[model samples]
Target: MQSTVNYLWHTDDLLGQGATASVYKARNKKSGELVAVKVFNTASYLRPREVQVREFEVLRKLNHQNIVKLFAVEETGGSRQKVLVMEYCSSGSLLSVLESPENAFGLPEEEFLVVLRCVAHVNALSGPKDSLPPKVSPRHEAVPGQRASSPLSAVAGMNHLRENGIVHRDIKPGNILRLLGEEGQSIYKLTDFGAARELDDDEKFVSVYGTEEYLHPDMYERAVLRKPQQKTFGVTVDLWSIGVTLYHAATGSLPFVPFGGPRRNKEMMYRITTEKPAGAIAGTQKEENGPLEWSYTLPVTCRLSLGLQSQLVPILANILEVEQAKCWGFDQFFAETSDILQRVIVHVFSLSQAVLHHVYIHAHNTIAIFLEAVYEQTRVAPQHQKFLFEGHFWVLEPNLSAQHIAHTTASSPLTLLSTASETPKGLAFKDPAQDIPKFFPKVDLQADYTTAKSVLGAGYQALWLARTLLAGQELMLRGLYWCVETFQATCRRTLEVTRMALLFLSSSLGTERFSSVAGMTEMQELKKVTELRSRLRALAEALSRCSHSITESQTSLSNLRSELLKNRDQVHADRSIQQIQYCLDKMNLIYKQFKKSRMRPGLGYNEEQIHKLDKVNFSRLAKRLLQLFQETCVQKYQTSLVTHGRWMREVHETRNHLRMVGCSVAAYNTEAQGAQESLSKILDQVSHQLLQDRTREAQVSPPLTAPYPSPALTDLVLQMQELCEEMKLLAFDLQDNNRVIEGLSRPPSAPDS
Candidate 1:
């Protein structure tokens, strides 16, 4: 039954009730718009006038979408009592939704995010302006232990309160009201400012206020323990409440409860809240005179995933700290929560590639990243992976989403095909989103990594030292033709010799393919080859240890060489050059004015501070800039020149050593190749004799390596040479590393100004 109040509002429904006031759903008689009227009883007036006035002011001053709108204030005719007319949320409080049996175990993963965003983002539920991470997946495949996505409770309203310099000291599910937004979406709002207060971030509040279940340990001690209210509370007290509220919404129950429960053992509950170590969630037990037994885990009835729990546990444990000092402020809490929300878990179902049946992806992943993941399952390169969309083949890319293909609903698989089988004969794509990818060649990461010209130099390390003799002082770029040409020729010869060494190795060692052709195991040769490999590997390690001092010198020289390389044309490419120029200009400008310009460096730099920088380093003040120029330019360059000249000798010696090894490898290859040929021909003859007569004894004596290389007097010399073929690539990489050393020795000079 409806009741009329002062002929102004008709009380159509009873919304909710607290100790002081009853919220009733009412309709305005004049405009017929619905509003919530908070009718205060005699108990409400028992509070101080200051608290009441502050509450009213907070409601009026706060202007945000997440806050409940204050409509007007009115009084009843018969009782003559105060009533606050506020915006009526049709969807009711989050408390009501949690009360639903379906939500008894907390919201599904999807609903959990909606609640997460409603209250906050990827931060405070704001749009993606540094709020959510770029890859928060809205849709997800049903994986074991992963809760399906669903909407639920939120914290943005509380974030807004903190932003507005107010704290909703009471942040519980009941205080979070919800309204039906467009498309029937729930828009949660933070309400009930009776306990809220305007408090600065650093300022403290003396009074103990807030529901005991969600209160900080300090507040609980005073409120429930009946301790003296001497402990001060900061804005972080509200963070404690948010953690408790979030835990409740996520698991449909309060986190901290003593062995006998809060009501049964109130003092013990206080002990449970305070005594636990930091980052402990859901502290369950500790009765006096009993062994303490507690759990740091959420209840299994909760719907959040293990992945989510891992992410959520740290947040709850940090924010719900008994000690305010350890508690996370709004910023840290918001950032961590925002990061979790920003990750999008896309569900992919491939059509043609059956192995890639279901997969998870971050929405922000580019085509290359997405295909790499696809390749892990299908063995098809990303370039060859084409997803079927809109009657054509479109690859997974930054732009391709569940929305475009219309398989957004769960259980629908994304049709997938591999172009690796060869381009689909009649497959077509329009390429509207510029997703028409180009073919890419197979990549060698190691080769590519060492290929880029080192900033220090780009030639045989020894040639750089030789350049000093051929060209005058290292900075003399014009006379370095002989040095460059010589470096190129040495580099070419080293490669050609290395190839020769490799060819001999392959011919000597019988590979699996070689065994098929030769028709022999060559067991004796294979055994010797293994021993040779072990010996060579040991030798390589010894060489590395001997070159340790040279390696350190190279690193230091390389850093200086990098700095020099940045400005081959020092005035344009060099950053330090520009700084020196700016320092000089400022000094010259101040001198021309006779130091009369009373420009002081601004307290801080902004667009307005440009004017203040002109009068800097005037009169005697200009001397420091000259020192800066000498240190940053001439002095450093000169030091690098001396260092490079010294390191060049070691570089030249190392280059000579490598070339000598290469020449030896070439000689060893000839002996190895002949032995391999003799072994194969002998095996063929033995097989031929056996084929002619099964009972005949066949003699097999392969040709011996007459001029054996390195390991002398070895019948298995051919096998050893062949086995080292694969190891030779490691030698090539070592060669490349040494060649990349700082070799561009040059003389230092002043910046061309």
Candidate 2:
């Protein structure tokens, strides 16, 4: 036996030492497994035998996922010392993690939540831990066996002790150890129950036992007396210590302190803690003469999101209150901490000017989103989105991970960098009243005879006024159509963001094997259920508003561009025979040039062809001059003044259309940002519910994949069908994002217009 012990463990491999025992790293010879062995000192052997027996009995009986396991016990030969074997936690104690420099302001939100969910709640839930699908994620191990006692403590820490009627006199950070799993997942376990004692009922007392800084005021006051004070400690002592330990974990400092430090002046620490103002939850007075400051708020620099802080502060307050009568009972603390564990977290994004948007995401989502948001709102590309975290522009190096950034990443707004700018030319409003004089040119009757003889003729004035005013109104109509299309586009994009989030959550429920743990289920029911319902109803309402946004444009520019072009054909040359002959000759010359250019580049238009083109140009001008001289060609027109009324009406109608379109676009961005927040929150809620539901359902259900599902459960088919529809929508959203990214260099080619 001595030879095996010598071979398995090295003499110098001491892990830690204390007054009662020294822990050493060792391995099992038979199993080839690593373990820790604690050998008692000579003096510990001389103590009362039941004290040692009670310690071992507690370790053996309290088996939980959150409690460390007991492997076996053996004695070393020659030394006559009793040796205890225990599970080895490769990761150090929780104190070591808190001492890290980055955590000087407390854990980042991501890390804090990990600790909150896994260690803080300490639930004795059913089913195995780390139940996520093997290929998709790493596994977390649960305790090897079940607890012999009832699982009464949902908020069990000391609740672990509370359930077993055991009170751990010391519940500080150093006593809480961490175990690293094979996959590198760490599980926190309540350890070192050397001062723990079992009670018969809820109301019980014992001699004061704990570290000074974390000890409750009642316990500390008695512990430090020169002549020991007569006072009894109960299960509630653990509650107070639990509060202090958690506060230290959260903000990297103790909540209550006095002159100098707790170690230097333990009496002062007791007075400050027990004699604070009625409602104060936390306090510290660093100097002997310094005034004490008290408040209910967590330090502002703590990485918890504002939304989460609102939930957690109340829980901390109830537990940490100096007034013992007001402190929350065990059941209340359990329920509240469990609430913190369930819900998916939310992060806030603040753009310049304190405009905030909520999203269900963390720091690891993507860097592209910030740049996208800037471009989408401002149409400003070539932008650099400098991220500010911890008061400096966050240089996102490879080492700076999403977890380090905390739970601040979320659904981000994005826009394409357009190489070509697009300004949708909507309706143009013009007053024909100002433009009418160009057609008539204000001139005295005698002056017009010398300098403006051509314009003075009534026929020319009537023809010009009708043609010019009609042309201007036709252009405005084209712009009005463009505005209608743009509004339709914005509406569709908003709907897609909302729909995709819901679909992804639904699809994930059907496809994945979710983690079955405490609090996983309730996070599924976020308060945003009403927000989701409101958003759906509002979508239908928006359709009508968008239609009204373009209402005036439709009536004002009712004519299509195709109709405007076709109307021009009948007006040219009025079907005269001479004009038809001239058009046919021009068409013949154009066709010859088209044939030459199509067959080869720069091969058309020889010197002979150029000479013919020059002759044609000279002949056309000469014919036009001859027309002015001939009296028979001169024609007369009247009522050119009557076109003024029609032109003025077109101008007024176009302006009204422009006003409505402007308002719709101006309001779109604010609406989109709000809708994004509500949808993101709703998606997170549904995802948690699905995970919890699946975990509980899987525990007793038949192999859902058995050759056939249970014949009595006919709804399985319906469930599968609903999930299939959700999966299809989720797939479409993913593919859409890919398509958008690929097309960002240029827009997709427009269909033939």
The candidate maximizing lDDT is 1
Candidate 2 on 277-379: residue-level lDDT in tens? 6546678886786877887878754545555665667777776655556766555565556544533343322221111222222233333443333344334
Worst 10 residues of 1 by lDDT: 453-462
TM-score of 1: 0.46
| Poorly placed runs, candidate 2 (over 4 Å) | 1-11, 118-161, 348-753
Model 2, residue pairs in steric clash: 155-334, 342-523, 362-409, 426-479, 459-637, 524-689
Give me the displacement of residue 347 in model 1, in angstroms: 3.0
Provide the overall lDDT of each model, using Cα atoms, as 2-decimal numbers: 0.51, 0.48
| Model 2 C-alpha lDDT versus the unseen true structure | 0.48
- What tens-digit string does per-residue lDDT give for candidate 1 at 421-461? 32111111111112212112322222212221110011111
Q: What lDDT does candidate 2 reach at residue 719?
A: 40
